[model samples]
Target: MIPDVFAYERPETREGALALLAEHGDEAKVLAGGHSLLPLMKLRLARPSLVVDVARLYELSYVREEDGFVCVGATTRHHDLATSDVARASAPLLAHVAGQVGDPQVRHRGTLGGSLVHGDPASDLPAAVLALGGTLVVEGPSGRRTIDAREFFVSFFEVAIAPDEMLVEIRVPSNPGEQWAFEKLTKRAQDWAIVGAAVTRRASGVGVALINVAPVPLRAAAVEEALAAGAGADEAAQLAAEGTDPSSDFNASPEYRRHLARVLVRRALQKAGF
Candidate 1:
């Protein structure tokens, strides 16, 4: 299928991209890797009048550690994240998850911000970001503001980023001693998870985030609470489906998804050495 007709602009700098976004407003869409957006466009699900390409913005293609956090530029490729020693050292969970996304070709081209902003419930990065308590930095005409991952994703394929805003960076805390695991349930290795779970140990608490169990990726709040209350991994994981309202889809039944969520959460928590 062919995408709807649209004008394209390749911006070489962050400022230029943001300015284009501001100028075109809702009619424009930012393109980083185009892995997600192009498919949606081909299906006519998205038909932006202007496509502001930011793949050429070299400054937004870095993975580095600064201060107490790991700062990843929005345009950094998944393969870069997966292979970067800095990213692996500072955030191995993120690196591991990046390695599992799509195929090697996809990983070589897909951007983290593209995946996060696409807000697909089945995507690995969003759940990992949620578990890592990541923050997104965005730039608009007014300037920049930081949005926590919890607040960044609002609904299915919808994020908190304004039409005039372009995601500029992602910040994740350095949790070197944290135990983490990413369990993806799928029929094939490269397929999206029918259900997935990411578990990590925070300084004073545990973090559990689910993938493909709802309209958007979600945190397992009940499970987290159970863990916080000193429940064993078995007990806490039993509550994984307590608060989620997973829907039945062609790929899975609601009951099956909930069951998978519970099982995957348990396995992930155990694998994380909880």
Candidate 2:
């Protein structure tokens, strides 16, 4: 499959890229690492008239400490995250998920912002972000706005980012001593998860996020609430599918997905020593 002909512009600055998006609006698409968008474009599922490439925006390609949180630029590649000592020490869950995203080639080219902004329900990073309670910084003509990861994803391949906005950075607080686990079930090592679970426990509370359980990456509210109420891991994990409306697809039946969700949630909880 070939993508429809489209104009491309490599923006050296973030504002330049934003300007392109501001002008083209719905007809434009942002190209970060291009791992996700290029595939959709190649299949003709997305045929934007213009591609605003931000890969060369050096300022948007870093992993740094901001205040007490780790601020990752939108163009920072997954391989960087997977290999960064700062990320591994403070946000081990993110580093672990990054390594699990795809094969080495995909990780070398896939960006955290691209994965989160692409908003695929089965993606690893989004679920990890949700579990880690991260925030997305989106820049637009009106300036910037921050959206919590839990509220960032709206539906399958859908996010809260406006058409004219571009994700600039992701911010996550350091969780050095937190217990975390990510469990994904897939037919092949590099394949997308059929169903996945990410669990994290801090001094405050436990967070449980599910992948491929609904229209969007979702935190298991029922399970979280049960944990908060002092329920055991097995008891809380049994409710992992509560309120989810998963669809039956070629890879799995709705019931099968629900079952996987429960199994993975329980395993994640156990690994987190819940």
Candidate 3:
């Protein structure tokens, strides 16, 4: 499938890309690694008049420790995250999840910021960040602002990023020794999860986030509350899908997704040492 004709601009610097985005407004689409947007364009699902390429923004391609969190530049690829020593040491669960996204080729080409901004409920990274309690940093003509992961993901395939805003970085707490687990229930090795759960257990409480269990990536609030209230893993797992609204597809019924949520949450919590 050939995409409709569009102008392509490759900006060498971050500010340049943002400027193009601002100039083109709704007519522009930022290209990171092109894994998500290119497919949409080829399928004619997206038809932006201009394509702003930011994949060469070298400054936005690092994983490092800062303050008490790990700051990952928005253009950092999944393979980079998966193999980054800083990311592995500071946020092991995130590194592990990055390794599990798509396949080797996809990981090499998919950017963390692109995946998050793409706002797919079925993507692994969104739910991982939700469980890790991360924040997104965005910049636009108004300057920079930070948004929590919970607030960033608004609905199915939708995010809080304005048309002129570009996600700059991902900030996740440096939970160096926290027990964490990610369980993906996919039909095939490289497929998207039918249901997935991410768990991070610390002395304070448990953080649980679910993938493909709602229109947006969902935090298992009911399950977390139950865990904090002294209920066992099995008891808390019962509430895993209590507040979620799973989507039914050919591969899974909503009821089946709910069931997988309960089961996967239990297993994930157990792995997290609940």
Candidate 4:
């Protein structure tokens, strides 16, 4: 498949990119790593007239500890973040999930900000961020703002980012002593997860998020509330699909997805030592 003919602009600076976005409005699409958007464009599902390439924004390609959280620049590649000492030390779950995304080639080219903004329920990074309770920062003509990961994914293939905004950074609080784990069930080694679970147990309580179990990457609120109410891991996992709205596909029925969610959540919690 070929994408419709389009004009492309590679901005030299962060402000330049934001300016291009603001200028083009709805017709412009931000191009980061392009691992997600390019495929969509090739399939003709997203036919933007202009592409504002921000891949050259060197200023937005870093991973470092800031305040009490680890900050990842939006243009940072998955391979870079997965191998980053700062990310690995401060946010192991995210680092590991980054490595697990797609495969070697995809990891080398996919951008962390791109994946989050793409809002794919099947993606690995978004679910991990949700479980870690991270935040995303975006810039637009209106200026900069932060969106909590929990509130970022509004629905299937939809997010909180405005059309004229370019995501700039990802921030995750330090969880040095937290027990965390990720479990993904895929039909093939490099395939997307049929159902995925990520868990982080902190002094406050446990945070659980699921991938591909609903229209959006979802925080397993039922599981969390159940656990907070003194339910055991099995009991909490049993409610994994309580508030979810999963659909049936050739790969799995809704009933089957619900079952996988329960199984994966239990495995994740057990790995996190419940």
Candidate 5:
């Protein structure tokens, strides 16, 4: 399972990378940490003509706070997020979830943007970001625009990002000292979740998001709504799988995933002080 031969370019600047994308369009693929894209390429599921590597773009590898949000560069690694004081203070749920991703090697090389853009329903970071109510910033030939995390995942393995656009930053509202928790059922320590739930309680309200319970990383809207209407965690969690369409796989059946969703969501909500 080798990838097809492809031209490679390490862009020195963000603009340089965008220029390459604009030139090659759908035939080009942007490479960040390579944890996500490289696997697809190696499997021959993705056969791009060109790879625009942005791994060396130092400017896009930072975690900082600005205007009441924690802003993370697209190239910021999961290990960085897990260890950053800024991330820990402003977005503890994200920091914790980042630490929970894969093993140490994957955390050190996987970028937050890469994970989010991969749009995997079972990925930990996307569900965490969704629960945190984060936003994604993308830059392309047209310039930069912001997209709500809720609207970013379009479908299974699809995101709102266009071929010519590259995600640049992730913004989550600063929630210093917030109550948050992430719970998941995994077969092994580093295995992907059979079902995962991330919950956060900010001044705004409670946010609940689930992984591997639908075609996309899903916000448990029924659970959130029930909570908003004065329901207890136990009652709200009953609706955790109400709107999901989880698939039956060797790891778990759809019914089993739905049951896990309810149980994990309750655990997360309770831990988050809901």
Candidate 6:
């Protein structure tokens, strides 16, 4: 399939990209790695009149440590995150999840920001970021603002980013040596998870997030509350499905996904040393 005819602009700077987005508004789409947007365009699910390519914006491709966080540039590829020493040292859960995304080719081409902004509930990176309690930074004509990862995903395939805004960076608390684990249930090695769970123990408490168990990637609030109340991992995980609303699909029924959520959350919590 071929995408509809569209004008393409490769911006040399971040500000230039924002300018293009502001001018075109929702008529324009920002292309970072294109893994998420191109397929949708090919299917005619998306037909933006303009594609503002930012894949070469070097200023938006980096991994570094600042203040109390590990900052990752929006355009940084999954492979870069997986292999970044800074990410590995400060945010191992994020690094591990990045390596587990699709296969080598996809990892090499998919940007972290692209995956997050696509807002797929089944995507591994978003759940990882959610569990890590990260924050996203976006820039538009007005200026920059930060959004908590928990509040980023609004609904199925929707995010908080405005049409004229471009996500610039992601920041996760520096958690060197933090205990963490990710569990995914898939029929095939690279297939999307029917259900997945990510757990990480931070100074605040244990963070738990679920994949494909709701309209948006969601935090396991009931499970977290149980843990905070001193429930054992076994008991806390039983509440994994308490607030979820998974849909029945070819992969699995809603009830089945709820069951997997409970099982996997328990595994993840225990594996993370909870």
Per-model C-alpha lDDT, please? 0.91, 0.92, 0.93, 0.91, 0.94, 0.95
Error of 4 at 99 (Å): 0.7
Estimate the Cα RMSD of every predicted model relative to the unseen true structure.
0.9, 0.8, 0.8, 1.0, 0.8, 0.8
Candidate 5 similarity to native, TM-score: 0.99
lDDT of 1 by residue, 1-274 (tens): 9999999999777888888888889999999999999999999999999999998898888999988899999999999999999889889899999999999999999999899999998899999999998999998899999999999889888999999998889999987777899998888888899999999886867889999988889999999998888888899999999877787878799999999999999999999886
Worst 10 residues of 6 by lDDT: 198-207
Better of 2 and 4 by TM-score: 2
lDDT of 4 by residue, 1-274 (tens): 9999999999888888888888888899999899999999999999999999888888999999989898999989999999999988878888989999999999988999999999999899999999989999989888999999989999899999988898999998876777889999998999989889999888767889999988899999989999899988898899998777777887898899999999999999989987
Candidates 1 and 3: which is better by TM-score? 3
lDDT-better candidate, 2 vs 6: 6
Better-scoring candidate (lDDT), 2 or 5: 5
Please report how far candidate 5 places residue 147 from its true position, in Å.
0.4
Writing each residue's lDDT as its tens digit, candidate 3 over 217-252 gives 999999999998889889999999898898989999
Model 2, runs deviating above 4 Å: none
Candidate 3, residue 14: the lDDT equals 78
Q: Mark the 10 consecutive residues where model 3 has the least summed lDDT.
A: 198-207
The pairs that clash in candidate 5 are none
Q: Higher-lDDT candidate among 3 and 4?
A: 3
| Candidate 6 total steric clashes | 0
- Checking candidate 4 for backbone clashes, the offending pairs are none
lDDT of 2 by residue, 66-154 (tens): 69788899889999998988889888898889999989999999999999999999899999999888999999999999999988998
Pairs of residues clashing in candidate 1: none
lDDT of 5 by residue, 247-269 (tens): 99999999999999999999988
Residue 269 Cα positional deviation in candidate 1, in Å, after optimal superposition: 0.7
Candidate 5 yields a Cα-based lDDT of 0.94
